[model samples]
Target: MVKQFVRQKARNITPTQFIVFTYLTAVMVAALLLLLPASVKEGKSISFLDALFTATSAVSVTGLTVVNTSETFSGFGALMIMGMIQFGGIGIMALGTFLWLIFGQNISLSYRRLIMVDQNRSSLSGLVYLIRSLLLLALLFEGVGAVLIGSYLLAAGYYDSVPMAFYHGLFHAISSYTNAGFDLFGDSLQSFSNDYVLQGLTMVLLVLGAIGFPVLIELREKLVKKTPNFKFSLFTKVTVTTFVTLIILGTVGIWIVESSVYYREMPWHQQLAYSLFNSISTRSGGLATMDVSEFTSPTQFMLSVLMFIGASPSSVGGGIRTTTFAVIVLTLVNYALGRSEVRVFRRTLKQEDITKSFVVFSAAVMIVILSIMLLDALERQHFSLIKIVFEVCSAFGTSGLSTGITSELSAPGKVLIILLMFMGRVGILTLLFMFRSKVTKDRYHYPKEELIIG
Candidate 1:
C-alpha cells in the first residue's frame, strides 16, 4: 500500500524532482533511525539537528560529521550509516529497481525514466540490465574489499576479535568504495598511514567508484568479454583521461608542495604514499592518514581546487564533473587558437554540450564563491578564511575532508553546509531546473547582430 502510494505520487512529479524527493525521504528515514536510543552508544538521545545533519551527510555520501563515528554511534547506528552510504552512493532508484525485480514486479516506463534521470543516462533502454549489473558489480567489489581488508585488520590486531575486525573492514570497504568518507577508526586510517596494502586497496576502490559506472560497464565489455577491437565511447575516453590526468597532477603538486614541508622528516616511500593517498582522497575519498591542517598553505589551496573538481559524472562522487572541466578547457583552448570548432580525440564537440559545460562550470563557481563568503561571515571569528573555504568546498564537492572545523561550525554554518551538500548531490543544474519555467518552441528567429568582444 505504501509503495503504491509512493509510486502514484512520484508519477505526478518530474524525474529531477523525484530524485530530489527520494534523497530527502532517505535522509528523513535515516535520521529517525539514528534517533533511536539503541543506535547510540550509551542509550542517550542525540539532538534532532545533529541526527538530521548526519543523515543528510550519509544520504548525500558527504562525510562531514558533527560527532565522531566510533565514539558516538553504536554498532546499529554505524550499520545504519553504512546502509545510507550504499543507498546514496548507488542511488535510490537503482535499489528500488533491484527490490522490484526481487518481488517480481513489472518495471513501468515511469520507473525507467526515473532510473535514466538518476543515473544521468540519455536513454531509457537497458535500464533494468544496468541496475542489475550495477548491483552485482558493487557487491563483488565491496565483498572482495571486505575480505581483504578484514583479514588484514585481524592480522594487524586492529580489532580484538574476528567479528569486530570484519565489521570495521566491511564498514571501511563500503565507505571507501562508495567514496562516502565515513570511517570506523577515530582518526580515519591514520594509524595505518604507512600500510601500503590497505591504502593501495582503498585507492583502487576509490577510483573505481568515482570513475563513473558507465566507464566500468565499458571496461567490462572490453576486458572481460574480449570484444574484438572494442573501442571506448567518447564519454569514456574523456572521463578516464581527465580522471587520470587530475590524479597525476594532484600527486605531483602535493609532493612538490609538501616534500620540503610536512614530509621532510618522513622516508621517501612514506612521502610518496602520503602524497598519492592525499591526492586521491581530496578528489572525494575523504579518508585522511594525516591532518590536513599540517600541510602548508599552498598544498591546502591545491586540495581545495581538487576537492572542487571532485569526481566524474553519473558516479558516487560530486562536483562540476570531469567532462565539464574538460569541455570548458577545450573550448578555451580552441577559442584562443581561433579554431572554427572545439575538437577532442579527433571528434568535433557539439555546441550544445560546450554551452552546457560552461553553464555548469559557471554555476558551480558562483555557488562555491557564495558559499565561502557566507561561511566566512558566519564563522570568521572562529576560523580562518582558508579553513572556511576548504570546508565549503568539501561540502559542495561532497568530498568530506575538513581541517577539523566541522564540529565547531555554528548552527547556521551547519545548515549552510547541509544546503551545499544537497545541492552538490542533486546537482546545480538539476536544482536550478526545478525552479525554471517550462520551455516552448519560439517558432521564430531574431536578426543576427554583432556584439562587443572581450
Candidate 2:
C-alpha cells in the first residue's frame, strides 16, 4: 500500500514541475546546510526564516538579503553561497547535463528538449554536444573575468593575501557573469564606484551574461572554427540591440538626473562610470557601488523602468526580457506609423511573439500591482506607494535594486517579496501551466462583435 501511494504521488508530478521542485529543494537544503554551525562565524546558527530567505535570494539569483552576508556567513558558508550563485546563475538543468556529459552518459531526448527550450537553444539536435560547449564557454568567460578582476584587486590591496583575493575574484566574477549579483564585498561594491578597472570588468561580465547563450554559441561557431555562411538568429539580434539601447538610454537618463544632485561633487569620468554600471546592473546584476536610495526621484523612476524590463530571455538575468521589450516597442512604433506589421531588419515578427510580449507585460504589471497593495497594507504608514512599487518590482523582476525598503519590510511584506522572486524566476506562464485547465476544440464559432473603440 505504501509503495502504491508513493508511485501515485510520483505519477502526479510532471517533468516541468519536477525541474522546478528539484531546484527549490536543492537551494533550500543548501541554505540549511550553510546555516549549520560549521558554516557560520562564531558557530552561530541561523533561524529557520533567515536561512530560508537567504537561500531563496541566492537560489533565485536575486541579491536581496535579510541578514548581513559578510558578517553572518563564515568561509564555508561563503563557499556554499558561491555554489548557489553558480547553480542559480546557470540553470540547474544545464549543470545536471554538464555533469552527465563528464560521466560520458547520454542525455535522454526529453531532457535535451528541456534544455533546448529553457535555454532557447537554436536546435535540439546534438544537444549533449551543445551542453559541453556551453559549459566550456561559461567557464572560459568566468575564469577570464576572475583572473582580470583578481589581478586588479591584488594591485589595489583589496584583500590581505593572494588566496583571499583570488577567491573573491572568482566569487564576484561568477556572480556578476551569471547575473547572480552576489558580492563578497561587505558593502556590495559601494567603495569601487569610481574604480575604472572594477567598473570595466563588471560591465564586461554583465554584457556577456545578459547576451543569451545562443548568441555565444553562434559567435563561437562562426568566429572560432570558420563556419560557412554563419547567420545570427533573430533572437540574438533582437536581444543585443534591445540590450544596448536600454543601457545607453538608462545611462544617459542617470547622468542627466543625478549630475547636479547626487553626483554633484564627483568627477565627470567617475560619474559616467557609476551611471553606466548602475544602469546595466539595474537590468539584472544587482551589485551597486552608488547608494541606489540616494538617487533623485527622477533617477529612481528611471531605474524602476530599467529593472522592470530586466534581462534577456534564457539568459542568467530575469525580467520580461529585452526581446519582449523590443516587441512592445516595435508594436508601439508600428501603431504610430500606421502599419499593421511590426517589421524590423527586413523581417516581420510573428503575431504569436507579439501576443506573448503583451501577456508577459500584463502578468508582470499585475504581479507588481498586487505586491504593492499587499505591501501597502502590511507597512501601514511607513513607506510611500512609489517606494513600495519600486521595491516590489525589483523583487519580482529579480533585479534586486532597492530604495532602502527591503530590510525594513515587515514579515508579510518580505513573504510577498519572496513570492514575487519565485514568480519572476520561474515565470508567470510556468506558474499558470501548473494549474492549467484542460481544453477541447470547439467546432462552433460565435458571431464576431465589436465591444469597444479607443
Candidate 3:
C-alpha cells in the first residue's frame, strides 16, 4: 500500500516540476553546506537567508551576493560554492549523466526526458551523447583557463606563491567558464582593469559559457571532425548573428552614452576595453571590470536592458535567450515589410517557433515589469526605482550585475530576487510548462471573433 501510494505520488509529478524541485532542493542543500562550521570563517557566521541567497545565486550562476564571498567563507565553504556553480552552470542532469557514464551505468528513457527538460532540448535522441561531449569540453576549457590565469597571476606578482595563485586561478577559471562571476579578490575583475590579458581571457571564457552549447558543438564538429559540407543549424546562425550584433551595439551604445562621463578622460583603448567588457558582462558574464555604479545613468540603464536580454539558450547564462530575441526581431521586421512568413538564412522558420518566441518574450517582459513594480512598492521608501529596476532585471536575467544595492534589499526583496534567479535558471518556458493544464480535446469550439485592431 505504501509503495503504491508513493508510485501514485510520483506519477503526479511532471518533468518540469521535478526539475524545479530538484534545483530548489539543491539550493537548500548548498545553503546548509555553506552554514557548516567548517565552511564559515573562524570568527564569522552567516544568516540562513544570506546563505540561501548566495547558494541560489551560485547555483543559478548569477553571481549576485548579499554578503562578500571572499571574506565570509572559508576554503571549505568556497569549495561548496564552487561545487554548486559547476553543477548549476552545467545543467544538473547533464552532470548527473556524466557521473553515471563514469560509473558505467545504463542510461534510461526517464533520465533522457529529464535531460531534455533540463537542457531545454526537444530531442531525446543524442541528448546523452551531447551531455558527454559538453562535459568533456567544459573541463578542457576550464583547465586551460586555470593554467593560463594562474601562471599569469604568479608571473605578474598578483600572488606570492604557486599554490595560492593556482587556487585562485582554478576558482576564477571555473567561475568565468560557468559565468558564475564569483571573485576571491573581493572586487570582481575591477582590480585587473589595466590587465588586458586577464580581461581578454575572462571575456573568452564568458563567451564560451554563454553562447549556446549546440553552436559550440557544431563548431567543434566542423573544426575537429573535419566534417564535409557541414552547415550551421538555423538556431546557431540566429544565435551567433544576434549575439554579435547585440555586443557590437551594446559596445558602441555604452561608449557613446558614457563619452562625457566614464570615458571623458580615458584612453581610446581603455574606452573600447571597458565598453566591450561591460557589454559582454551585462549580457551574461556579470563579472565587471568597472564599477557598475560609476557609469552614467544612461549606461546603467543600457546595461539593464542588456541584462534583460541575457544569454543564449542552453548556455550557463539565462534570459529569454538570444534565439527568442532573434525570432521576435525577424518577425517584427517581416511584418513591417508586409511579409506574412518569417524567413531567414534561406529557410522559413516554423510557425510554432515564432509563436513560442513571442510567448517567451511577452512572458519575460511581464515578469520583469511586474517584479520591478512589486519590488519598488516594497522598497521605494528606501531605494530608488532605477536601482530596483536594475536589480530586478539582473535577477531575472541571472546576470548578477548590480548597482551596489543587493545587500540592502529587504528580506522580501531578497526572496523575490531568489525567485527570479530560480525562474531564470529553470527557464521561463519550463516554468510555464510546469503549471500548464493537461492537454485535452474540446468537444466544441466557440465562434472566432476579433474585437480590436492595433
Across 329-427, the per-residue lDDT of candidate 2 in tens digits comes to: 999999999998999988899997899789889888887777778899998699887788778778877877777777788777777887777777776
Count of steric clashes across candidates, in order: 0, 0, 0
Which residue runs of candidate 2 sit more than 4 Å off their true CA positions? 1-5, 43-45, 120-130, 437-443
Query: Candidate 3 residues 75-121, lDDT tens each?
Result: 99998988999989998899889989999999999989999999999
Is 2 or 3 the stronger prediction by lDDT? 3
Q: Which residue pairs in candidate 2 collide?
A: none
Query: Which 10 successive residues of model 3 have the least lDDT summed?
Result: 290-299
Cα RMSD for candidate 3? 1.1
Once superposed on the true structure, which residue ranges of model 1 sit more than 4 Å away at CA?
A: 1-12
Q: TM-scores, in order shown? A: 0.96, 0.94, 0.98
Q: Give the C-alpha miss distance for residue 94 in model 2, angstroms.
A: 0.5
